[model samples]
Target: MTDRSPRASRAGLILVPLLLLAALTACGSENDPSPVAPTAASSSSDPADDTAATEPPADAEPAVTLVDPWVAAAPQGVTEAYGVLVNRSTQARTLVSVSSDVTDVVELHETVVVEGGQMLRPVDGLEVPPQDGLALLPGEDGITLVNVERPLEDGDEVALTLTFDDGSSLDVVAPVRG
Candidate 1:
């Protein structure tokens, strides 16, 4: 005699519709057809969707520009340079950093008053507004590049890359001026 348990019978009953549904889903329907919509889980895995999701943001500012870059000529073993960082952007921007390959250290420095006397101090950074400029004037008790580590001869050139607040960069060739 064949023995059939209640659980086995119930399992067989549930399995029939599941297999039928799988077969029907696997086959594409033609008549009374509706466009299939992608499930959210599979939709995001698409290559096109991944690209669109990773694309850079729009309304990003155009490239930044630097104008009239020049540095004062110095004697041998001179490591400091001074010039103007002019922002040619139509929008205001703050210079977050400056760097050069000619010097061991590059910084945005300013001269300010301190206890009992004036002092030349290094600034965290500098700001240059739209259509404006930041002056790096080296003078007595005034803002200047301190303790330069490289020799800047006349006609020598160095590239200064300025970073703006808007995640853009500009490279300017600042020549050593006489």
Candidate 2:
């Protein structure tokens, strides 16, 4: 003959309520959706927005005006030209590629510092951030080119065409500088 204990018999009584409590807790509370829709002003109320919006019309062609558009006035032995790029538009643009008559080939390149020191790295393209611009200037980091396949002589006018991400292009006359 076996005797049954009250504690064991009443175990289900305590366990059921605990299990129900857990199940209820597991059901997440309902969340009220936010009433406000996100907008540029609401999200990022930066003053730059006003400047960017007022600068140019949306449908205007991108002006790839080369800033300090000068190439090294080195002898004809020099095969590369260095300059800077500025996108004077509200919309973001990309430097897809550059072509110059001065050089047999032109490529969009970027510089990266590697290891203990700075190193030059070539990038397929560069992005001009919205409301801002990009620089192709030379630094301790490196420089980009309207690389001429051949050397450009002083007074030799080179045409550089910058292709935008939106399939638009800008022509800049890159002049050789001292």
Candidate 3:
């Protein structure tokens, strides 16, 4: 009879590699875990839960919202715009500059008591606090729109662009009011 022991040993050596290869291939198959489904307690059908999901996170980007923006009616020469700058973000922002098609020059101004007289002075920028607001009124403390192209009449809409230090800008068509 032929010596079968050596042949069997050789066959076993080949089968060992095949078995290891099968084991490795099995492990390499896609076995990603399924996403967890929302439970009844966390479902958004509840109004409170829906609101929580829609709210921005604590570290979300700063959101600057302009509310009730209006330009004062000017018979001639210069005037100013008024509004509430609401900052909903966690970080403070700066109002860098302002522009408008109705005027050639727009600048940020603040009122200061100088020698017991309140005067308007140009400021580089205005800081808007986080979760707070800044009011731009028609006074020495408000922003000044200089050299208006024409007299802004009541009920007219003027396009105003506000620039922030973060390179973001807001364009608003503010209504002209007294």
Candidate 4:
């Protein structure tokens, strides 16, 4: 007689999935050399859902989005990107880093009043409140692109990639303007 218990059945089901996952992971394409980041289960007990911070909940909305993205017109030297970072997710999002197609060096900056005058200073991150937004205004808070590679003429577009604290990134094209 074969002994088949509920626990034994559950164990077999779990083992099958694990084996299948292992096999699929090992079968990578020849051209694809990048590794996919692992996402662990969220330990939160929210009533809505439990998804990783890097991902939106079951509601299916993106965590953050860019609005009115544009780069300042510059002949060379330094310039900045202007945009409004809108947060639609339940949790707040923090912008940790920013990069552009025109320049290799980018930084988060804010205007600070000093004894001499108001000066631009570096900031670590910019937080977008839940269901709110943070605007990048000139002479206020923005992403500074130092040592621009070429001239940023009006109507030209630059590709911008913004990374958040959750390790999720969003890409957008910003048109050069005044």
Candidate 5:
């Protein structure tokens, strides 16, 4: 019985060290910034990965940036697009025209109060001040898409081209939402 007790104590000593080593190895240090393994959807070989492609080039800085452009869902007749136009340049810029593939006519419009009712009035252009921005919002100020060829539903995507007064144009895809 005495010999058996010594053997059991030695076994326990060996097992304890092994368990401690395993626990230390499993816990990684916080300072290590190891890259995680990419999932199947975000793999490099997937052609749908547009994160790198959509980024603007480092050498070129655009004067104007359209933020969160979206189109409102409406019936077959007409809808509107809204977004924020941010101007980074020192000179003012004007939105000259807007065209969309889903609509034959696109017009800039502003809401006005007439006879205690609100109405959308057509406007020639929308201006963005120097080093400032403009928000094309709903109900009051927005771009109206006239003669829509098809009915717009929520989650539909529409392609639009916005032309500026300086002959510069920007192509954007606006998502339709209610």
Candidate 6:
């Protein structure tokens, strides 16, 4: 297990990208200039719906965005992806599954504090709150790639697609490091 957050990636090729992410997150974007949430449509008094949100208008922003996405380096076996999942839309989204280019099996996992220590358990889905988000941190909630086909090394990248319950999906390239 590895700490994939930028705070833990303090060395090697990983630090450059993680530090940039930290700086950008700390500084904030120039165009929108909101807090963690982006500047998008506000909540409306409509019945809760997730299907219709499958596709957004060309001008519309993404319902969810991954901030500083990254993974821990590993020669093989399992590795977890970490990032802040920010849901910009008013409706909540559930991350049902994850597909990876390097691994055939990617499962959603949640870390729970047991009597002895901590344990990683498989979960059906990870929910992202409306106009809020969820953090995929190591030893916590995240997606795990089982039996990676190739070595995941520092500065390498892994392509992942996050499919939501609403039929929406987001493609991300997460950096590999320690």
Descending-lDDT candidate ranking: 6, 4, 5, 3, 1, 2
Instruction: Give the best candidate by lDDT.
Output: 6
CA shift at 133, candidate 4, in angstroms? Answer: 0.8
**lDDT digits (tens) for residues 34-111 of candidate 6:** 454423443343456433344444554467778779999998998889988877656899999999998899999888
Instruction: Kindly report which residue stretches of model 1 are placed more than 4 angstroms away from their true locations once superposed.
Output: 1-64, 76-79, 88-91, 114-118, 140-150
Q: Which pairs in model 5 have colliding backbones?
A: none
lDDT of each: 0.56, 0.55, 0.72, 0.75, 0.74, 0.76
**Clashing residue pairs, candidate 3?**
none
- C-alpha-based local distance difference test score of model 2: 0.55
Q: Write the per-residue lDDT of candidate 3 for residues 93-167, one digit (tens) a residue.
A: 899998988877998989777897678889999887775667665443466889886888999999988888889
Return the TM-score for each candidate structure.
Answer: 0.51, 0.54, 0.64, 0.65, 0.65, 0.69
Off by over 4 Å in 2: 1-64, 76-80, 140-150
Give lDDT: candidate 3, residue 11. 48
Quote model 6's TM-score: 0.69
For candidate 5, lDDT tens digit of each residue in 1-178? 3456644554454344345434543553222212356566656775677664455444443566676799999878888898877675568999989999898899998788889888998988888776566677666567999899788999999999998899988889999997
Expressed as tens digits, the lDDT of each residue in 1-178 for candidate 2 is 9877644444443344345434543553212123345576745678766664444445543444455556666555433445445454456787777676666556555555578865566666678655343544543211244433555567777677777788878777777765
Q: What lDDT score goes with residue 95 in model 1? A: 68
Best by TM-score: 6
Better of 2 and 6 by TM-score: 6
**Candidate 3: count of backbone clashes, pairs at least 3 residues apart or interchain:** 0
Candidate 1, lDDT over the whole model: 0.56
